[model samples]
Target: MKKRLIYGWLLAGVTFASSCTKNFDEVNTDPYKATSENFNPNFLMSQAQIQFSQTGYDQLLFQSMWVQSLASTFDYYANGDKYVLRGSGTGYYSRTWNRGYGALTLVDEMKNLVQGKTQYSNLDACGTILRVMFIQRITDLHGDVPYSQEGQAKSGNVAPVFDKQQDIYKAMLSQLDAATAALDLNKDKPSSDLFYGGDISKWKRLGYSLMLKAAMRLTKVDAATAKTYAEKAYAAGTMTSVADNAKVLTDNANGNSNSNSDALLVADDFREVRWGKTLIDIMKTSNDPRISAVAEVSAGTGKAANEDRATPGVNTASLQIGMPNGYDLNGGATDISKAPNYPGTSPANPAVPNDAPAPVGKYSRPRLTVYDDRSGVNMLYTYGESELLLAEAAVRGWNTGSAATHYANALAADIRSLAQMNATPQAVVSDNDIASYVSRNPLNTANTTALQQINTEYYVVTSTTFNFNETFANWRRSGYPVLTPVTYPGQYITGSIPRRMPYPITLPQTNGANYQAAVANQGPDNFATRVWWDKQ
Candidate 1:
C-alpha cells in the first residue's frame, strides 16, 4: 500500500505524451496529471478487479491459523476439557492487517474506474460485488472494522473509524443486491475471471448467495433479520445448481495461482496443526469418502485404526492444540504433511496435500477446505449451501420454502458438486459409483435424522477447501452432527472452545478507541468471547 505503487499502477494504462522540452534541450512530459479520457475502461477495470479479488484468496490460505485450527470441519484444538481458539498465535499478522486491507485499497481504485462512465455501467456491477465481498470479509473477521472510510487512508485521515458489524452487514447486503440487479446479461465484459470465466449469471448468483450467507450469520442474535435476508435472497434466485458455484483458480504460476503447500511443512508453527478426531470418526462411521479425501492413508495407522485419529503432535511449545474448531480425538493428532498426498497423490491427477508438516517431516494428510484446488477456486454459494440454509431456516420456521425438498436438494447438489471435484484423471468417480451410497448414507429425514443429514453435509460444503467456517458456525447455531471434545494443554486458551478470534496485537496502535471499546463492551475480546451473532 505504498503511495508510490498505488500511483504508479493507477496510471498503468494511460499513455504519456512527452513534451518537446521546457528549455528546448531537455525533454519534458505532460505533468498536467493524467485523465481517464484515453484509458481503456475494460483493461483498467480487469487489472484492478483481479488484483482486488486475490485479497480474499490470499488471506484465506496464506498460513491462516485461526481458520485452519479454529474452524476447519475436520479439525479441533482443546483447552483442557473445553475448547478454544489460539488466534493470538504468531502466523497471522499478514492476514490480520496486510492482505485484507491491501485488497480494500485496490477495490477503491476499481470503484473509481467505472464510476460515471455511461458505456461501462455493467462494469459497475462487477466492481460492486467484489468490493462488497472484501468489506464483508473485513467485518466478519475483525467485527466493527473500518468500512466506509477505508482505502481512503492517504487523504490526511489515513486512519478511519470503525463501523458497527450489524450496520456493515446491512450496507453490504444493500450493495450486493443493487449490483446484482444492475448486471446486464447481454453485455459482454471480461472473461478473464480467475474464478468463473467472467460468467455474470454465476457472479450474480454468488451475490445473492452471499446475501443469504450474511443473513444466516445473524441467526443467533437476529432471527427476523436472518430470515428477511434469506427470504429475499431465495426470492431473488440464489444459486440453483452446482454450476452456479463461484471459485478461485490456482495454477500456481508464480507458484501460479497456487501456494507453496510445501513451505509450511518446514515451519514449526504450521506443522503443529493436524486433523481433529471428531470429524474423522464420523466419516469412518458413515464410510464417507472424504475421510481419505482429507487425511492420508490413515485407515491402518495406529491413530486411524485404534483411536480413529490422525494425530500430528505440536511438539513445539509455541503452538496450541484442541482448536475452537471442535474435531479432535482422545489419543491422536492431525498431520499437516497430508496435503501432498491427496487427490494430488499421483503425478497424473494433480491433487494437492496442502497441509504442512513439522521440521522432523513427521505428519499425515491435511484436511483441506472447499477451495483447496484451482477447480475449487469457485466461490461456492451453492444450491447445496442454499438448500441446507433454507432447510435450517424452515426447521426454525423462517418461511421461505419446503424444508423437505430443500433437504433433499441440499444432499443432491453437494454430492454432485463434490463428485465433480474428483473428476480428475486418477481420482475420477463413476456416476454409478456412489449413487447407492448417497441414497442410503444420508437418508432423508424420517424424524430428526433429516436435520442431522442436512447439517452434516452443509458443514462439509461451507468450506471452500473443507467446512472451515461452516463447521463451527453451524455447530454453534444448531448443535448438530454431535462431535466429541479434544485433549490439549490449557495455557493456550481458556477452558473451552474460544469463539471470537483475539483482536490482533496491533489493534492498540491502529484503531485504539474502537479496539478498547470492544474489549470493554465484550470482556477480554478473546476466543471465549462471542461475536454479536453467536447468541449463546
Candidate 2:
C-alpha cells in the first residue's frame, strides 16, 4: 500500500510540472514594467527636466534667504534666514545632492538607451548637455562631487570618488563644446522635451547659453579658461532673445506642479515669507518696474486673512514694504515687531474669531496670481542671464560683444521674461513699458561700477524670477549687491555669507572613504569653505 501511494504522488507531481512549463516565459514576464527595448527614451527627458527644475525647499531653505532674495520668519526657513538648523535641516542639506544625482541618473539611463543609435543623435547630444548642466550645478553647490564614476552603481561602482571642482569645470566645458556642436537640426528632436517642445534650434541655443554661463563661472579662478570658453560659446551662438529662454510650464492636472508654487502655498510659508528688504530696497531705489510686477501687500487684516491664499493682494509698488531677514515672530528680541522700519501689524479681522495680528502682514509677499499658480512656468536659464554674462565677459575684454548693448538687452529681456512665469500671463510688462524702463537704466560701461551694476542687475533679475540658486552663486562670485551677513545669535557660519552648501549629513556613513577624502581636500565639509571658482 505504501509503494502504491508513492507512485501516485510522483505521477501527480510530474503532471503538475509539465503543465506549468507550458507557458513559463509568459508567466514570469511583467507586462507592466517597461524594458529599454520597449520604452520610449524620450519620456525620461521629461522626468529629468521636471525633477531638476522642481527644486522646491532645496533652494528655498538655503539659497533663497541666504542671498536675501526672499525672507521667512518660519522655523524651517531659519536654515537660511538665521543660518541655524531647524525642522528637517539635515534633510534639506541633502536635498540638492540627492535630487541632482537622481536627475543625473535618469539622464544617464536616457543616454544609454540611445547611446550608439544614429537616429537618436539629437537625444544623445541633448543628454550630454544636460549631464554637463547637472554636474556643473552639483560641483558648484558642493566643492567636489562624483563625476567620472557618477551613476555607475549598476556597473559595480557603488562608491564613486568625488572629482575636484576645477577638473569638473574643465570636463563640463569640453563636453558642452562637443555636445553643442553635435546638435544637428536635421536629426529627430526629443518628443518629450519640456523646454521648447523638441525644437532642435532652441536646444542648440540652450546648450551654448548654458556653456556661456558655465564658462563665466570660472572668471575668478581661471580667467584664461573663462575667456576661451566664453568666446567659443559666443561664436557658437547663445540665446539671442526671450524666445530662446529655457523654461518649463508645470502641469498640475498631471500631478507635475511647480515645486516653488507648492512650497509657497503651504499656509505657514505663505503667511510669513516676504520679499527681503535688501532686494525690495534695490528695486525701489532704482525705480524698478518689476517691483509692482513681483511683490504685493496682503489684502485683508489679521493672521487668518493674511495667510489666505485665495484672496489677491495689493500690488502697488509704493505700498510694498520688504521684511528684513533674521527677524521672526518668536516674540523674542529679534521679533518682527522690534525690526527697524517695521510696518506694524495688520488690523484684526472682524470676520475671524479672536485672530491674532499677522506679524508680516504689512510686508511685501510674492503675488499670489504670479507665484502661487500650481501650473506656473519654471524659468531655468534665460536670455537675460546669457546676455548679462556676455556683458560681463565683454567688460573683462573678452571678444563677446559690446558691454552696454548686452546689459541693456538683458534688462529688456528680463522684463519680458516675467510674463512667461505665470500660466495665464500675470506679470505683463508692456513692450513700451519695458523699453522705457530699459532706457532709464542704461549700462554706463565707462563707470568703475560697470561690473557691479551689471551683476547687481543680474542679482535682481535672478531673484525676481525666483532662481535663488543662481542668485546666491552669482552673488558669491561677483560680490554684487553687497549683502550684509545676518548675525543671528546661534547662526552656523560667522563673518561671511555661505560660500557653498555642506554635503549631505549622511555622506560620511554611506560613502565614508570618498566623503572623508573630499573633506580632506575641499576643507572641513562646512558652509564657510569656498568652491574652486569663488576666488578670494
- Indicate which candidate wins on TM-score: 2
Give the runs in model 2 whose Cα sits over 4 Å from its true position.
1-33
Please, what is the TM-score per model? 0.72, 0.95
Per-residue lDDT of candidate 2, residues 1-536 (tens digit): 99999999999989987998989888789998899788999999989988988888989889999999999888889999999988878788888888889999999999999967898899999999889877777788888999999999989999999998888998898998998899898888889998888999998989999989998998888899999999998998999899998888998999998899899999899998899999999999988888889999888889888988999999998998888899887898999899998888898888789888877899999999999999998888899999999999999889998999999999999988999997788998778878888899898786458998899999998998988888988898898989999988888898878899999988889899999999998888889999889969
Cα lDDT tens digits, model 1, 1-536, are 59989888666634233233335333343655466665555554444444443433233332233323222322222222224334433345335356556766665665676688756666667767777766665555556677777778666776676676777878887888888888877887554454456777777787888888878878778878888888888888788887776544444445434332332232322333444334444455666544443444222222212122233322221121222333332333433223223221112112323332222122333433222343333233466887788777777676678877777676556656654442252222345545554666544545467667777767555542443434455555555656533334444454444355566677779778877876776557655666666657
**Which candidate leads the pack in lDDT?**
2
Residue 36, model 1: lDDT of: 61
lDDT of 1 at 436: 56
lDDT for position 130 in model 1 = 72
Worst 10 residues of 1 by lDDT: 341-350
Candidate 2 TM-score versus the reference: 0.95
Query: Deviation in angstroms for 33 in model 1?
Result: 10
